[model samples]
Target chain A: MSVLKVAGARKSFDKTQALGGVSLELGAGELLGLLGPNGAGKTTLVRAIAGRVRLDGGTIELFGREITAATNGARAGLGVVPQEIALYPLLTARENLSVWGRLHGVTPGDLAPRITRALDWTALGDRADEPIKRFSGGMKRRLNIACGILHEPRVLLLDEPTVGVDPQSRERIYDMLAELRERGVSLLLTTHQLEEAEAHCQRIVVIDHGKVAAAGTLAELVEATVGAERRVTLTLDRAPDRPLPGFEAGESGVVVRAHVRDVAAEMPGLLGVVRDAGCKVTDVEVRSPSLQSVFIHLTGRELRE
Target chain B: MIPTLLRIAFTTLRRDRVVQMSVFLLPIVFFTIFAAIFRSQTRGVTAGVRAAVVDEDHSEASRRIVAALAEEKGLRVRTAARPEGAPRGAAEVPLDRARALALVKAGDVPVAIVIPAGFGAGFGAFESRAAPIELLSDSSDPVAPQVVSGLLQRIGMTAAPDLFEKLGFSLFERYGGPMTGQQREAMRRWTSSLTDTAPAGPGRAPGRRSAAGDSLSASIVPVRIVDVLGDQKRNPVVALTAAGIAVMFLLFSASSAGGALLDEVESGTLERLLTSRAGMGTILAGKWLYVTLLGVFQVTVMFVWGMAVFQLDLMHHLPGFFIMTFFTAAAAAGFGLVLATLCRTRQQLGGVSTILILSQSAVGGSMFPRFIMSEGLRAIGRFTTFNANALDGYEKVFWREAPLTDLWPQVLVLAILTVVFLAIARALARRWEST
Candidate 1:
């Protein structure tokens, strides 16, 4: 069963329509990456699902139950880690977790253990008693996620959870998210990190201009946008004496570029052609279409723009 | 570098709304409030002095004197007795001598007058032995007694010219020569008859006017004002000022603390809280609770400090003081929440709250006594939470020794304001729950 489903969610702020009929689904244990350029309604979609932003038109469902007119209680099983660090600076990590846990209706008897486990999960147990202001950025980010998950929600919505974090911290967050996924917690992650999405997410939904531009796996998006083709380049020791067929010499006349339907199928034949052309190859590189290229191709703009 | 720095400074000042308000708008608003207060004070609008009269003699002459004193526009006379059909818990009995003295001691009335026995007869002959009129006054209320004294002198002069003339002749007789027994006995006989009938002729009764003549001596008033409070030390105005300033700043502090809600929104904590099971009502209620408690604590600290430093009579006024404090704090808390919810940002809240609180404080009598303000201004002040109601309640408790029931109007006003402010705050907080 799908853990979360947002169908045709639409919202507007004053003159700007933040979401224009955006729809997506997340199955149990699946990590769905919400990819969009800045101001493309990624946050708006997440906020609508979390019940923070009221939609002008839409229906949101969890586990096949519709919650279109429900209060915060209807979204009780849903966890949200906003883009900004939301924990109180004056409160200790454990105290912050306790507050959020209580707010989510964790009983006092269960709250203490849940807070301890959450702190341990974030690897902040040793420093759980320290104020959040004393924590490093990465530590604060981890605690921010920990606060949302203490109630053990069935679905989690994270908006740019790893922005401005060190590589080590980013990896730690990814691992933590992976652990949550293993426990059948579906996640809808909104991020500007295309490479992170490409590496970690099971599926991607690209939204632009408040509408879904494309949705698929990495290979499928690449195939759909730029076709199933690979760019092959051969670096030679010296300039080729003659041009090879179905190939052209690149800048400085020392490298040759060839586009092929399949790199594995056409690589040997292309090398044979290079050899016949009297080219001594020192190195060869084959590249497939990337998520960045797919994003740029579909959105017609850079991700950060 | 100099030009670049100057440009940056000017640009920042122009761009920042909070800075612009603080620099240009605040001074003008503050100046207007203070100028109004000062101007009203200098104009000397008479908010009447509260006083009571104890007619111990209960004679027509004493009653006339009481009536005359009551006619003064500068005095607001209250009988020692509660009016007939007055509501339960509001019964105040008219002052007898002991009760009048007690009221004076409690500082409830600035002055209380006692018309002793034989005071009526003293109106007939100036040389007659009469009990003096006692003026019991609170040492703290010096100005009210002086005004009362002046009114009494005017009444005495109007009622009795023969009394003064007889006293003058007696003084002259004693200084000029020793009177023979026959002469003294004849003078006494003439003085005795003055009470029953007007003197018949010259030397018929010493210093008496003819029965046929219409004269100022038709009635004699030998009243003398004796100050009952001699060298007593007390200053209730200090307590008034302390309470006024304390209540004013307590409101400002509560509003500033309410700005914490804006901080939460800016930090994304509000959104996080909203996404939880806690609804918008719960979040707002929680904030209101915190602000109210903060207000209570702030005001308590101020009063405690006032008691220590300025000798404020907190202990004597404990019940009324605490009641006023609670209501004032609640109203302030509600006001702060409304202000915070109405503004979009912390800087906006700061600028708006500063203008509002300062204006309220200035007009409300924190900066100046409401008693000295013009009637129109005082009417405006009565609408403010602190100036009109809370500070007045505190003063009544601390300086006037008024009963708890007497403060019902002020309590009702504060309660109403608290409800209104909270309701508005809740409505405005809906903006946070949506986009």
Candidate 2:
């Protein structure tokens, strides 16, 4: 059964329709990535599921129990990490974790062990007693995530969890999430990092203009949007006199590209054409379609735009 | 490059409403409030010195003096009381010495005039060694007593000229042979029609009595100033000053502490907390409680400093002081929360709270004595601003030395205001919950 499910959630802020019937689900022990361009309703859908937002028309179910703003009994099982670093700057890391733990109804007996584990997980054991204001951006981001998971909620919502952090911290955060998944804690995270989503997420849900544009694994998204054709490229020593048949010249006349389903079978023929065109091929390259291309194909815009 | 920098700064300032309000509007607001306060003190309708009058001797001279005092535009004379704790239909009785003294003690009037039993016999007897007229004054307001004393001297000269003339004739006879009956009769006829026209009125001549005028007019009336509170207080003005400054700064710090809510909202912590087990109401109540406790601590520190350095007599008034302090801090915390919730950003809260607290402080007697303000402005401060009631409660504790039970009215008003302010803050805070 799904640990968290939001179906047909609709929300409008003033005249702007922030979420128009967007729906997604987080399965038990699954890591789901919510992908969208800016203002694409990923945060709105997450907020609705986390009970921070009231949906105009929708149902949010956690562990098979319906959750609404008024009926929030199931909310205790949900944890949310906002896009901004929400911890008090002057407070120590342990203090912030303790506060968030208590706020989420963690008992005193369990708070200490949870904070200890969170400190170890974030790799800030020695610096746990220091004020967070003195911490680096990546350290603060790790602690921000630690603050959210102290209560041991079944479903976690992380919005831009790696936003302003270095790559080393990002790797550590994904490792931490992988451990949580190993412990059977389902997670739903929103990110503009398409590469992170492709590498770590068990499933991806792409939302655009307040609606879900595509949802599936990387292979499924690739097949649905840009298809699974690998592109072959040849870098010529000099400019070609005429265009090669069955190949298009790149922006630089010295480079030409062609798409092929099977590179092993098609590369020799492609290389023969380069030679027949009186162009010596200096470098040959073949690459599969990536999530970025799939995202651009689906949204018709870059993720950051 | 300098011109570009200037343009950049100007453009940013123009777009920032908080900067505009702080730079341009706050000064205008403060200037207007201070101008109104000073104007009311000098020439407004409530500029008159409120004096309670007691007439022990109802002789012709005493009655004439009382009449002239009542006619003086600079003095507001109250000669009767409706009887304290009396029924609604109780007949008003003339003010006696005890009632008049009570009025001065209770701060109902700054000063009280007592026309002694033999003041009429000694009227204008330049060297007769007669009993002097008594001016019972509360020393807290140094201005009212002085103003009343000067006006009394002017009234003594202008109100009863015939008595002066009679004494002058007797003195002339005693020194240089008896005056002729013709001369005495002529002087009496000339002084009988003197209508007490001295050009001495409020906001004009007598109101501006200087040191020179005071000395020149000192001999007309043998007046004794009895400071009602000076003898009891170690440092006479310290209590009022401490209370006023303490309450004003209490408001400033409380609002500042309440700005933590805005900070939480801006930092996204509030949204995170809302998703926790605690609801919005719980979060607000926690913040209000924190700010209230902080305010209490802030005021205690101020008063303790006052006691240590300035001899404020805080230890003597502990019970009433604590009671007033708790309620005052609670109300101020609520007021601060209201300001925080009413504005969106810290800058907006800063500009808005500055205008509001300063305006309230000026009109509500924190910056100056409320008794000296015009009656209209006093009423506005009492009705609209929380500072007035809070200060009144403190005065009752420190100045009047009244028991804690006497503070019910001020405490009740502050308690009601605290509830009202919290309600307004909570209502305004709805924007942060589930939006």
Candidate 3:
């Protein structure tokens, strides 16, 4: 079943268009990634799906139900971990989960085990009772995730939930997503970290300037990468102001280009040709385009810019 | 959904410590300021005034009149050299009717007292029913008229007993009865004292007595000072300040609640709340509920403190006081919501609320007394709800003995003000989420 679908979604704030004609769909048991630079409307799309924002022109559907004007109760099947930590710092992890659960109308009799199970899912069971204020960034992020999913919503939306956490916590979050996938939980995530999306997301949607640039499986995206062609680099003992075939100048050293399917496969022959030019190769490396490379190729600007 | 919204509102209220402290502390702060003002010493009307005694008749009665005016509290008697330029024996130009009026016009003395010619005829007429005493006094200032009137009444009260005694002795003399030895002795004593001690009449040589004994209470009798109104006829300013401070902080509490709204928006707790089955209206309603309750609580605490320390007796007149104060708080909270919604940031809220409070305080009669101001200024004060409901309400409850029924006018004004502000607040709130 489709967990969520957005068709021709548009939203504007003041004079700034935060989301413009964006559309996407997510399936059950899938890890979908919305990738973009800052101000790219990734958070806006997530908020639209979470029902925290109103779409100026479009509709959002969750679990095959038209939820364009869904009341908060109509959204009980959904979970959202917002871009900013929404958990009360003065409240403990357990308390935060209880608040979310109670607000979602979980009965008191069913609350305890639910909280415990949620804690265990996020690896926060040991620290569930500690105040969020006393928690580390990673711990607070984990609690944030736990609070949203405690009621076991069918679809989960996390907006840059791991942005400011340590690498260990990042990996831990990846593992938790995997566990949720095993439990048949559909997840939609927005992140700026391209590699993380490439690693964990089954499908990555690159959004730019408030619209979707690309959406497909990782292999499909990689095959369709904007800087899809690979560049071969030959590092010399010193900066060799030397001529090379199909070469583009780079700041660090000499560079040569080839398609991933073509010249990258002929690296040895290319290296031999360089060798035959009476120059010794200090080091040789083959590089393929990444999602960032794809982004730069599409927008003709650096992702950070 | 309602519970969740209420929880969010209450939680937000509890979380912002600065707003919380202000909301809770405003009433106390105002109470303290007003209490201190009320507890200060009261100054009587006519504490100092210059007057010249012109002795056309040097009768003992005129001297006695001068003596009486000298003994009066708050009158600073200045002896002028002459009634025209200056008096001979008086401290300053002795203020007769015309001179005192001119001095008052020129802003010299608040009031001037003149013992008129034939002044002893009035006293002698009481014994023989022949003539009445006439005194000239400046009545330009409202307070001056009141002071001159009060000083004259005091003299009349003091002289009534002796006049009756002399009249009784005269009556006895006319009856031609075999007078008792004691009665004859009393008549002889009166005659001797009157003949020997009486000044010629009317204006006597100015004496130094009016300066020696007058205390400050004899000044400003018409203007009801806060202190005079508060603790035991506290200085009129004190009572006025207390009432003003109480109402000011009540409005202040409203802004504090408004501030909490900003905190909620900033916290992302509001977002969490909205996404969780709590509609924006539910959240807003809950916030309004909490803030209004807080305002009521703020007023109650202030009144309780006032009653405890200042003996304001909110309980004895509990129904009236509560109804008046509670509605005032509600209206204030409503106005506060408008302030909060219009302001985009907490800092903006701070600036806006301060402006609101100061403006209201100035026009609402908190910072100063409005009665002494001109009719136009007083009319300008009535434009603000704080003045319309507050002064009228306080006057009805604190100064006058009135029941809850009397507070309906104030209540209606405040209620209407509350509704208008709340409507404005609601309209503003819809745009606030985006801001």
**Which one is best on DockQ?**
2
Residue pairs with clashing backbones, model 2: none
In Å, candidate 1's interface RMSD is: 1.5
Query: How well does candidate 1 score on lDDT at residue B85?
Result: 44
Best of the two (1, 2) by lDDT? 2
Shift of residue B385 alpha carbon in model 3, Å:
2.4
Clashes within 3 Å, all models in order: 7, 0, 56
Ranking by lDDT: 2, 1, 3
Once model 3 is optimally superposed onto the true structure by TM-score, how far is the C-alpha of residue A196 displaced, in angstroms? 1.5
Model 2, residue A210: displacement in angstroms?
Answer: 0.9
Off by over 4 Å in 3: A12-18, A69-73, A89-95, A107-109, A119-131, A227-286, A302-305, B1-243, B307-315, B369-379, B394-401, B433-435
lDDT of each: 0.79, 0.87, 0.67
Q: What docking grade applies to model 1?
A: medium
Off by over 4 Å in 1: A241-245, A248-253, A302-305, B1-4, B48-142, B147-170, B173-242, B304-319, B400-407
Ranking by TM-score: 2, 1, 3
Kindly report which residue stretches of model 2 are placed more than 4 angstroms away from their true locations once superposed.
Answer: A234-256, A265-283, A302-305, B1-3, B184-188, B191-216
TM-score of decoy 3: 0.66
iRMS of each prediction: 1.5, 0.9, 2.8
TM-score of chain A, all candidates: 0.95, 0.95, 0.89
Candidate 2 chain B lowest-lDDT run of ten:
B197-206
